[model samples]
Target: MASQTDDTDRITVRLAGREHRDWTTYRIDSHLITPADAWQVTLGIPADALPDTVKPWAAVDVCLGQDVVLTGRIDRIEREVAKGTNALAISGRDGAAVMVDCSAPIFTRRKATLTEVVDLAVRPLGVSQVRVEATGAKEKVEIEPGMTAWDALAQACEANGCWAWFEPDGTLVVGGPDYTAAPVATLVMRQSGQGNNVLSLAVTEDVSGRYSEVTVLGQAHGTETTDGQHNIKHQETDADVPGYRPLILVAGDCDGAAEAKRRAQKTLMDSRLEGFTITARVRGHRVSESGKPWTPGQRIQVVSEPHGLDATYFLMARTFLGGRDKGSITELTLKEDGVWLPELAKISGGKGKGKAASAGKVVELS
Candidate 1:
């Protein structure tokens, strides 16, 4: 009976238009920076219970309850036999898998809008739904040979201090978190063991790649007719870095001094991301208060006096696990808030297409 209940749990996977559950083992992994969400499931059953039509490359939809969470295609399948019972396992990635695996459509665009770049990179892969919520000025970018679709899209978005990720329904979204939205749930780790919902909270702090100061230098031409600038530099300091460890990088190119500052700030944030992370393990797969799965890019309040931690964090990754041997578990990977948004400049005036003044330099490659 317990095994039957486990197989009929709320999570289900639809393949080839047929919903399937009763999984003997399952794992789902999703991340904010990763292009694709991945999932795997295995089952041991009589050979007759297996579907002959279910094969690799078949379209799949993963869902919790009635809401879909992932739209992807199967990548691999394995079959094994032991003691006259056959076990079948399959693994796959979401729509962005193609972007990560295939080369981008080669193109050189002049003064390209962010949305345009995203469409150019993903549409060829049969992903026509793309949204760019993060604001940025029209950029002159060249997507040369050998770049993957994901690389091209990420480069254009990251240059503007934004990121590209897929929505549950397979729409590509280019934006940062909506900081104004309220936190969905609070994880309390009280020393008194009262009102605590957290099963385990682990904090990791490493300073190996962290630094107090970051300098970014670049060179670039202003426009088609204007002269290019050289030696454009910007430096940003991180008060969080307790010691004076400086790092400098030569940025390949910059739109101006403004872009230089943005680059420097992004570097500093990257250091912060590397320096600290919080991992929380909790019972069940959904947020208690919201009834929704714990999702990446959401804000979560964490109060743990034992670790001297009392701040909201950005959920950057989440994983769900459950099988015959274990109950449902959700593991959350979080980072300090506001560090994910890189704060790149956006164009203003005249439909947000106007170019800002060049403040830095764009370095040329030899």
Candidate 2:
């Protein structure tokens, strides 16, 4: 039988049973329970404070008057759905009957084992690496004897550079890219001058993964340069170049210098100058030079409204040239709109001159 003595305390009969013995204890609370019928129970203990001896699925007995009721293992402690008060749900073992929504608060379960904790923590990081904390009171346990899944998960993240956090709605957040970490491969492109004459160069390294292709995008212009002997050098020209557009470079093999020209050709054709008048000097020779008696590679300069830069001319010559030679490809961009004219302009004629012209010439895109 249950009875109340004062406003803050009450006496209730509690029965705990096992296979061999049964015992009863008197339960008391700080506040008097009204009608002694329905009231909430709370164990004001931190999750970590509980002992490790408690099993995940252990049961305790509860007996009230002539009616005998049983409560099973504690799954978790949650706030009351309606009143927002702390409450617990005792789950029964296999084939065992248990009561739901009990009024009195019962005992709290122990913390999870060390093994359980570690397992939960390592699950999300994948099997790449493992790092354990060296200093901390919690770190003392090589393996937590009894820890919850959540606790293990948190620890694993701290060790493996991975972490989980809750969103505003209590949703879990996980994996993100590490931008500071260097990429496995890089594709570098360089341009020496401005407008249509801007030289475009490309190189690739450390690319182990399967990527179909790479691209470089920028404006091109037409210009001329003369050597000490007064030889004229022609450059790429474009009438209408957009502020920004993507250029795509595709090739069969990413290895060796032969692929550099292929990639460069793709860049010229895919750039904003696709439909603009342009001339390309690929692999140290002009496009119009190819197939000519004096020219080793083709050096075809065209003024067609939207002629895509010729890729075959550049790629084939570059393959034959071989190595990391600097004289691979040079493109020029036009500053003003006009008909094509040939003049011996110096290579170092821009505002920034020698240094600035070399800045973006060989930028690695990947």
Candidate 3:
């Protein structure tokens, strides 16, 4: 279990099924946009305390108190010995690291389901368990010879309006966030120190990759039996972009106008993911109210008078820093709203209907 005080939280690492604690410093970074979470630790122990013989590539489980935060293999280990000091450092990434580094299975299947495609991408990588929460009609799936496992899974998931990620226990999950879920915690920043729980908060607004409009042009190839030629295209506009900046994309996989529109919409969502970001730094690795470790994809309520923010934000990423000078700290990366919808705007009703702009707006911290 993680030992927690009012100020800081403790961490433990189980290497080859043996638990070890008392690290001098550690940093665990987890995020939703990235492929995998990363972790590293430094141990300041005496020469005689280095009794364990475990080397690099050993299976490891990192826990924040009782919750397993990361499960993977150690990637590197470094040892330093001074005249009177000895230090050891270990670093690794979560199970998704393997999927990001290794190539997926190269095959083509006609009328394949999401589960079948996910199986092809993960099974060869030794990821046995898979939970696909989203469903879609069967479609033809083709993977190239050198595509990364993460890329293969992403392509499959995006077609179904879902995303793929690994759980703490190494289970591959294919699903989308439930936007209706309640906020887990409320973060407050007051002028007086009495009611303030946040150490520091920062917001960043970027529009480099963001576009005012996106157009996807695609051509449907004729089958062997037929020689029909068709041109398919779709366009989406971003209200957030004030200028006339436009982006044009060519999608070879688009089958029709609908597919092309989805592709264009996804581009807007990607822009929103990079447009605005909020960073919150707080003490302890866990939330004070829930007593649970900070996690990605959870909604958090923000109440900052200085920033004039009294809205809910989504937690896109969080980093846990232990053994710092002040105490254990959690740095949260937040988006304007939780979850990145392909439209980047709320859908009102059915197909061909206009989308309503999102309630949240990008705020300039300056």
lDDT of each: 0.75, 0.25, 0.73
Tell me each candidate's TM-score: 0.87, 0.14, 0.87
Q: What range of 10 consecutive residues in model 3 has the weakest lDDT sum?
A: 347-356
Candidate 1 local lDDT, residue 306: 86
* Local distance difference test, candidate 3: 0.73
For candidate 3, write residues 1-366 as lDDT tens digits: 123333226677877556667678899888776887899988777676654645776788888866888888788889999887788898998888888998877654334456766767778887877887775535455667788888877777777667877777777777766545567898888777668899898877788988888899887777888553367878888766779988999876567777887778778777867887779999888878888889887878777777766777778889999763536889999876632753322322211111212424321111
Model 1 clashing residue pairs (backbone): 219-361, 219-362, 219-363, 220-361, 220-362, 254-362, 256-359, 256-360, 257-359, 257-360
Query: How far does residue 140 in candidate 3 sit from its true spot (Å)?
Result: 3.7
Instruction: Report the Cα lDDT for candidate 2.
Output: 0.25
Model 3 off-target regions past 4 Å?
1-8, 51-53, 107-113, 137-139, 225-229, 324-326, 342-366
TM-score of 3: 0.87
lDDT tens per residue, model 2, 172-234? 333221222211211122232222432333222121221223342222222376222222221
lDDT of 1 by residue, 68-159 (tens): 77888899999998787788898999999999999878655444456766767778888878887776546646676778888888878776
The positional error of residue 222 in candidate 1, measured at the CA in angstroms, is: 7.1
